[model samples]
Target: MLQESHTAVIARGQHWRGEVATEPYEAAWAKEAIFFLRALKVEGSLQGTRANIQISADGIHWADEGSSLAVPTTAGEVTFCRISHFGGFLRLVVALPEGARIQVVASLNLKA
Candidate 1:
């Protein structure tokens, strides 16, 4: 049988400051998933910045799934993280340096 797959663009040309979480996605059918985060531009240092893949049951609350992406300091760089055994809803949460802003595009890829 062929596997099912899908990609969702959660954040598009959006500017992130301090900390932010991408919109939730429902993918209970998916057995595997990956998140791609692209930094288009940065207003300050990317030091100490991190992005984590979070899972949720009702889409309103979230918990870290231990899957994380190491955010690059350089602009135009892309980072990714893989996750599995996630319950249903998923999202990406990023914590950036204080007073720094990053314009980014976040994509969630899933397969079953």
Candidate 2:
């Protein structure tokens, strides 16, 4: 049987936001997991210089798993990518380089 556990809470501020979590299971059960991340309904008059999303297993350590996902918005909502991978732990980090306040919504799906 496959199961999931919430290991962290993700909240976004006016500038940046992120979260991390881990799920333990038999390594032989599955090889990888798929994470669907999105940046939705952002409203503002600021130019987003850059937006980045990344994942990590150790929590303290991280890797640029979802780097190519970025959307520049002056108004309206924008969606990013559907990233899939395998790891013991997982985290989501988003950065807005322009320093403008941004509203973001994100979620993750884990498989093992």
lDDT by candidate, in order shown: 0.88, 0.42
lDDT of 1 by residue, 28-93 (tens): 999998898888998888876789888999999888898889776778899888888998999988
Best candidate, lDDT = 1
Error of 2 at 111 (Å): 3.8
**Lowest-scoring 10 consecutive residues by lDDT in candidate 2?**
19-28
Model 2 Cα shift for residue 95 (angstroms): 2.9
Candidate 1 at 44: error in angstroms?
0.7
Candidate 1 lDDT score at position 38: 88
RMSD of each: 1.2, 5.8
lDDT of 2 by residue, 1-112 (tens): 5464331224332233332222322222334443333344454433544444445555567566554445436434544444444455444454444434455544443344
Candidate 2 ranges with C-alpha deviation above 4 Å = 1-9, 12-50, 72-76
- Report the alpha-carbon TM-score of model 2 versus the true structure: 0.50
What lDDT does candidate 2 reach at residue 68?
Answer: 47
